[model samples]
Each structure stands twice: as C-alpha cells, then as structure tokens.
Target: MKATTRKIRDADATKARILAAAKSEFARVGLGGARVDEIAERAQANKRMIYHYFGGKEDLFKVVLEEAYLDIRNAEQALALDHLSPREALETLVRFTWQYYLDNPEFITLVNSANLHRGRHLEGSERLRVASRRFVEMVRDILERGAGEGTFRTGVDPVQLNITIAAIGYYYLTNRFTGAVMFERDYMSEDALEQRLAFNIDTVMRLVLA
Candidate 1:
C-alpha cells in the first residue's frame, strides 16, 4: 500500500510539472510555435511521459486551456452570490474577473494566441464552451432575479451585459502595454489598475441598475 501511494504521489507531481511547463511554453511561443521537446525539457519529463499522460501536443494544449477555464469558473462558483444584492453581485463578478486577469496573465497570452489563429486550434472544445456557458448562465440568472426583485433595471439582456462586463476587464489586460504607451503611463500601475477596476464596476452598475 505504501508503494502504491508513493507511485501515485510521484505521478501527480509529474503531471503538475508537465502542466506548468506546457503553460509556459504555450504562453511564450503560442500553439503553433511551441515545441514538444522544449515542453519535455522544461517539465523534466521524457517525451513518452507527456504522450502517456496527455496524448499529443494538441490534446495537451486543449487540457491546459480547459484547466484555465475551469479555474475561473470554480472561482466564480465560490463567490456566494446568494448573499449579495444584484448590484453587488455584478460588482463582485467584475472585480473577480479583473483580478483573475491580473493573476493569470498566462491565460491571457494563451487566449490571445488562440484568437490570432481564429480559434482553429480550439476545435472540439465543446466541454470548455459548456463551462463558459454555465458561467454566463449564472450571470443571466442573477440579472433576472435582481430585476424581478426590483434591484436591477429591466430590459437588459443578461448575455449582452455579461459580455460588456468581460470586455471591460479583458480589454484592459489585453491592451495593457499598448494602453501604457497610449496613455503615457503604466496602465498596470497599482493605483491606476485598481482605479480602472473600480470604474469598471461603477460603469456596469450604472448601465445595469441605474
């Protein structure tokens, strides 16, 4: 039993290492440019181990993307929306999303690279799409409940509102360097970023609840 447990622990460690290496590779070189050899070296695992654990490069990439999506979705689920008023829920979601982008810059890079290829590399990603849809549905339900209870404005499409919220958070991170150049200052500066996040939450509230 001890031997089995040790083997399982080692396997888990190896899997974690591979995932970390894959994320770095995908972030730096993107899907088309990333090499399996480099990922193997970075993970300190042999090529066969990677294939054994995650099939091939494309499959591994898909797993990494799905893992990122799941991370955000899990965080959203953990927000305890039942305790917050509709406006507050919106604020929490926005803040969570903003912080997520800041913390998961690698996710941003991976997503940007996928978009650059027109998402061709993300074909057969129905599971990921379903997870995203669940998150969107959660937002929609919150809006509906809020409006029904007179806590939010009527006539707003939850899908559109959610998209707008995502845009406000994602656009800033996606264009941080360009924003810095355009604005003649660091867009990611501590105070500046927090101010932007606050402004975004306020803007959404104004549009949705005012």
Candidate 2:
C-alpha cells in the first residue's frame, strides 16, 4: 500500500509538471508552433512519459485548453456572485473578467490558438461545454433577478451579455501592443487600465440597468 501510494503521488507530480510546461510552451508559440520535445525538456520529464500520459500533442493541447477554461470558470464560481445584488453581481463579473485576463495573459494566447484552428481542439469537450453552460446560466439568473427587482431591462440575452463582458477586456488586453501604437497611447498603463475597467463596468451597467 505504501509503495502504491508513493507511485501514485510521483505520477501525479510528473503529470502536473508536464501540464505546466505544456501550457507555457503552447501559450508562447500556439499549437502549430509548439513542440513536444521542448515541452518534455521544460517539464524535465522523459519524452516517452508525455506520450504515455497524454497520448499525443493534439490530445495534450486539448487537455491544456480544457484546464484553462476550467480554471476561469472555477474562479468565477468561487466569486459567489449569486449572493450579491443583480447590479453588483454584473459589475463584479466585469471587474473579475478584466482582472482575470490581466493576471492570466497566457489564457488569451491559448484561446487565440484554439480559434486559429477554428476550435477543432475544443470539439467533443463536454467538460468545457458544461462549464460554459453554467456560466451562461449564472448571467441569466442575474438578469432575471434584476428584471424582477425592476432594476434592469427585460429580454436581454445572457449569451450576448457574456460575450460582451469578455470582449471588452479580452480585446483591449490582447491588442494592447498594436492598440497602443494605433491609438498612440499606453493601454496597459496603470491609469489606462483603471479607466478601462471603469468604462467596462459602466458599459455593462448601462446595458442591463432599467
């Protein structure tokens, strides 16, 4: 039993390292440019171990992508937005979304890579689909609550609201470099980010508020 436990622990640790390394590699160069050999070196695991655990590169990427989405969804769940007032809940969501993107820039790149392949990697990912459905339901609940309280407009689509909330932050941060050059301003400066967050909150509130 002791030996079995140790073996399982060691295997779990190795798998974690591989996942971390693969995330970094895939985020850095995307799926098409990422290499399994580099991932193995970065993880400090034997090459065969990766194949043994994850099957192949594409399969590994799928797992990594699923993990990424799950991370955000789990964090959102932990926010307990359901307890807050509808308006507060929506604002909190916008704030959380923006901050999350800022803190996890790699998530943006991984998403872009997935989009580049037209979400082929995400196909058949029931896990991701379930998480996304829950997220949409969360927003729908908020909208329904607000409408019931006469604090927000009725008939708003939760899916559209969710997309807008993500887009407001995602587009800005992902385009910070080109946007800075194009707009001739620093989108990532402390003040700029603060202003953007404020704008996002206001935008979302206006869309939902009665």
Candidate 3:
C-alpha cells in the first residue's frame, strides 16, 4: 500500500507539472499555436506522457481553462470574508481581485484565449462551474449580510456584482497595452496601479452601498 501510494503521489505531481506548463504555453500562444513538445520540455515530461495523462492538446486546454477558473475561485474563497463587515469584506475582495490579475497575467491571457475561441473549449466544464458556484455563494452571503445591516442595496444580483468586480480588474490588465498607447503613459506603473485599485474599490462600494 505504501508503494502504491508513493506511485500515486508521483503521478499526481507529474500531472500537476504538466498542467502548470500547459497553462504557460497556452497563455503565451492560443490553442492554435501552442505546441505539445514545448509543453513537454517545460514540464520535463514527454509528449506521450502528456497524452497518457490528458488525452490530447484540446482536452489539455479544457483542463487548463478549468484550472484557471479553479485557481481564482479558490483564492477568493480562502479569504474567509464572512467574519468582516460588509464594506470591509467587499473592499478586501476588490483589492484582492485587482491584485490577483496584476500578479497573474497568465490568468488573464488564458481567459482571453478561451474567449477568443468563444469558450467552446470550456463549454461543459463542471469542475469550473462547481468552483464558481462556491464563489457565488460567498458573494451571496456577503450581500445578505450587507442587506441586513442596511449597508447594501437589496436584490442586488450576486453573479452580476461578481462579474462587475472581475470586469473592473480584468479589462484593465487585458487592455493595458492599448490603454498605454492611447493615454501615452504606462498604465501598469506602481502609481497607476494604486490609483486603479482605489478607483475599483470606490466604484464597487458605490454600486453596492445602500
């Protein structure tokens, strides 16, 4: 049993590495351009190993997409905001959401690639849905608490609120290149990022506050 468990652990580690490497490759180039050999090299595994583990590139892409959503949702849930005041909870979430995008550009790139493909790759990702459901539940709990305290608007849709929060951060990172060219300034500088995070928090508060 111990040997069996050890083998299982090793397999799981190899699979995780493959997923991590694939995320990088897919982020760098979309589904059409990512190469299995490169991903194998990056993971220090063989293409046959990747195939044995995940079937093929498209299936691997789907799992990569699932993992991306899984990561953000997992991080958000780990904040445990139920203990905080409604305003404080939301602010923490806003700051976290913005900072997460800044810290994880690969996430934005992966999502953009998925969108470019019209999300056909992610069409029936039950794992992604389950992860997202937890986040929506967390948001709903926050909204309910805020409503009870008379600090937030009643009947506000949690899904829409979450989307708005994500949109505020996502659009900024995803469009930074164009934004810099348009504004003639670096939108990703420390000062600029601070300003943007502040704006997102204030905007979300205004939208949610009673």
Residue 176's lDDT within candidate 2 is 89
Whole-model Cα lDDT of every candidate shown, in order: 0.86, 0.94, 0.93
Better of 2 and 3 by lDDT: 2
lDDT for each residue of candidate 3 in 1-210, tens digit (9 for 90 to 100): 999999999999999999999999999998999999999999999999999999999999999998898888999989999999988999999999988998898999898999999999877988888888888999999999999999998999999999899999998887899999998989989999999999999999999899
Number of the predicted model whose TM-score against the real structure is largest: 2
Give the candidate number with the greatest lDDT: 2
Instruction: Decide which is better by lDDT, 1 or 2.
Output: 2
List TM-scores for all candidates, in order: 0.91, 0.98, 0.95
Off by over 4 Å in 1: none
Candidate 2 lDDT by residue in tens digits, 1-210: 999999999999999999999999999999889999999999999889999999999999999999999999989988999999999899999999999999999999999999999998988899989998998899999999999999999999999999999999999988888999989999989999999999999999989889
> Candidate 1 lDDT, tens digit per residue, 88-133?
7888888888888888899888888778878775677787788778
